[model samples]
Target: MSPLRLVIRLTAVAAVAVLVAACGGAQDPDVARVATGLLDAVDSGDGAGACALLAPPVRTELEDTSGSPCAEAVLEEDVGAPSDTTEVEVFDTMARAVVGSETLFLSRFDGRWLVVAAACDPVAGKPYDCAVGMP
Candidate 1:
């Protein structure tokens, strides 16, 4: 095949792959569940439960920054108790959940969803400012 035709075919395949991945993410209920579960745990003061829902890196970051275990350190953060999850959008292994006024980012690991970032607020023309993890 000509180089131009090969490039076009590859581009089309990539687009289709992205669309399929996005659709699959949208339909995954576990993403929403994990996001809300974290919020619920926080609201109920279940530090251990909340920490369990966090991604390993995020948990490590919290523990390292606070010089405490994740269970204790997670509770100390200003992660708000958002009563309702308004929206959840997943893209492949990554996810974004909007719970009340706060935004959370998550990732899927071993078929389990885990929160990678929480207490995020959007900054115009910039990445989110998160109370925990990357934006």
Candidate 2:
């Protein structure tokens, strides 16, 4: 093969690789949808709706709390709105979202995604455990 032709081929390959890397590594939209639903539920003060969107363990915990002040505290926070800039990491049937200062970990169960855990702080207050609320 001619040296010039080889160079052209290599450049084309490199360009294609860059384009794929840039456009193909996007996070799944379903994950974002789950995150948005959870956030909206919380912001709207829909504890039942939020609980419905929680994984089993977290739902159980929330239920056992029996309407504690912890729930109110979570509902009161100005955690900010969901944004397109949120980061998501997806696993087999689970995902985590980092939106602003809050981090929500979720799971896909029975064909729906539900939040399992949410925490704004690592050391303070009751971290909203969504798994505890599942009935």
Question: Number of the top candidate by lDDT?
Answer: 1
Indicate the residue-level lDDT of 135 in model 2. 46
The local lDDT score (0 to 100) that residue 75 gets in candidate 1 is: 81
Q: State each model's CA lDDT, in order.
A: 0.84, 0.65
Model 1: per-residue lDDT, tens digit, 1-135? 999999999999999998887686776777778888888888888999999899988998888888998888888887777665468787878888887887889998788889999988889999999989941
lDDT of 2 by residue, 1-135 (tens): 999999999999999998876555347677667777767778788666655666776655654565654345445444446555678887667677777666777778887777777644455576554322334
Candidate 1 local lDDT, residue 26: 75
Q: List the candidate 1 regions with Cα displacement exceeding 4 Å.
A: 1-20
The segments of candidate 2 whose C-alpha lies over 4 angstroms from its true place after superposition are 1-26, 67-81, 122-135
TM-score of each: 0.81, 0.58
Question: Clash pairs of candidate 1?
Answer: none
